[model samples]
Target: MSDRQRLLTVAFYLAKFNDEAVRNLGYVNFREAFNELGAKLDYSPNSVKNRRDDFDPLFGHRAGWHQIELSKSNLEIVEAFDHLSEEALRAIVFDLLDESSSKQGVLLADIVQGRQAPSYTTRGVTGKKAEAFFINWFQDHFPQDNLIDTRDFGCGYDFGVIGSNEVYEVKGLSGIDGGVLFTDKEWKVAAELQDEYHLVLVKDCFGEEPTVEIYSNPHEKFSPKKQVSTTININWGISVSEFNELDKE
Candidate 1:
């Protein structure tokens, strides 16, 4: 199944229990949920756990504070809706499953980064907000420039600019010195695209106004080593000392 489909399946599975599960809230056992979801979805228990890892943050619910498993190496926890009402959660899940491209886009962005930092949950909704902020700023300054959202393509880049023959891997950082995480696919894309690939850093995104730093030909500027088999980490402040600052409104 496609990544989109897998996420939708998970959403669908969760919605099934909304009526009865609402009562459990903070007390629902994750194992029970996983068993039913995995059985219906034909997924392994581990897969259900993995999907919940992504869902916990999206749903704005966490159970680690209460349900703790000493035997499970990863510390199995059960999380349920806390931020939104059960009805609201069901509505959102339905919206996502109804082929809502925009909603899917937002959720996909959150999932792309894997389990998000807890601080991100505290900040606001989906990563698309930050990405859109930067895109808007870029469009305002370079009105003639054409751009394409490459996020759905999973091409390791967020956007592609026409005429410039360049693609951008956009990152939303908390500050100028914040960390930027890239997937292995992005690194490979950057290596292959080389000078044609750029890294657009959108910093101070959670603030009233955000600043953008565009690193043209990032593959030539930053040397990012693999953090894991699938992730790459780059410290922007240390790698690119000089980058053109885009004027923001």
Candidate 2:
């Protein structure tokens, strides 16, 4: 899809959520939301509003362009995403808006293949939100300390405290109590760091009032069992002979 079409589709989904979208996106009003999103996507505010209007008819939140049939692209977007619940669609729209999200590629690929995109698990979205909350909380609570984001580096921790021998691994739980997983690398790193490694757990992360608990040297404090799992990857390829035969055809 053209970039404009993609942006329009995202805007349409956002519109379906109406006030909830504005609040979740931290916009005080719809006009501001449209302006900011339009600026981010390099489109005019009016275009965003129009896209929202295209979807408003189906949702009945506002009087939109309902006199005529939806454009083919708009109709296609509706058909693809209309069945999703608000939370599910919000996750997808958020992913699509984020240029750096790898999930965007998977979702778009599935859409192009005429397949239903896999539903995003609540845990996945909640983890991201919790991480964001922790980043902000860390900045506010520890102004003297500097945190280097190591999440993308896969360094067995999410943040490394500069000028200190400390690293922090973050975990999020939607409710007060839930299980957390650690990869082999994280476990090894925690064992090595011992006193310096920290586990920052955010509880009720998806709720209005989230709470945080920090465990220093979690490797020593808690005894977690080791569970092993295996995954297999499959790839399909044509042999040279088969390729040659096809070429001859």
Candidate 3:
């Protein structure tokens, strides 16, 4: 299948899982088999019986999810359905479905292949994936708080909360030992925000479920720090273990 079709299929399946009618069932039948569900176990049968009604609208009433399995290279990527909002995913899928190059899409384009590239850098991709994980986590755990993605704002913070004064700067690493880099502007912003600034460090971003550690007003915690360079290599750095101690939880 084409990449467009594959992405759309994933998106549709995600939406179908969210559909209320399908969710009313205990489980859904993908290949003529019943699967145990976590939240809506009783709705499995209903989902199968009302399959057509569920998907009639294309995207159904968003519902609880149990699991979603997709193939990634030689491995199958299996994750629990946990998104409260599929808007980003839907938008990405729709953009891919559109054949017009004039339109800007979520996934970045590769210069050589002229196709959507997952990410430009390995670190960048890891950080993005981790951000998505945190977004889901916040939406699920802190339903009262509205989290906004502000990474594109170049405001030294990756996310912000609506109706709140808090801001978050996220640093993601594939392992627990990686160093966190902060630009001069980001350091200035962190110092300015002080207590309102949150430094979120995610470890093992691409492994299973990523681990999150948050530090409030992290600028105050760094001690015996030194600037290695002022010209091209100017930046503040810290080890993941040192940052983990600041975790509120």
Say which candidate scores most in lDDT: 2
Query: lDDT of all predictions, in order shown?
Result: 0.54, 0.72, 0.51
Q: Quickly count the clashes in candidate 1.
A: 0
The residue-by-residue lDDT of candidate 2 on 1-249, one tens digit each, is: 456656766677776889998888778998898898898778898889888887775666876754334555564565566667766666666776677886654655456434232222122335566788899899999999999889989789889988998899888776677667677899889999998999999987757888999999988898887654222122357799998999999
Model 2 global lDDT (CA atoms, 0 to 1): 0.72
Clashing pairs in 3: 18-63, 24-43, 25-43, 25-44, 26-41, 26-43, 26-44, 27-44
Candidate 3 wrong stretches, greater than 4 Å: 1-125, 224-249
By TM-score, the better pick of 1 and 3 is: 1
Q: Order the candidates by TM-score, highest first — what do you get?
A: 2, 1, 3
Candidate 2: residue pairs that collide: none
Candidate 1: residue pairs that collide: none
Cα RMSD for candidates in order: 19.0, 14.5, 19.0
* Runs of candidate 1 exceeding 4 Å displacement: 1-126, 229-249
What TM-score do all the candidates reach, one by one? 0.46, 0.50, 0.42
lDDT of 3 by residue, 163-219 (tens): 998998887766555556676778889999999999888877767878889999988
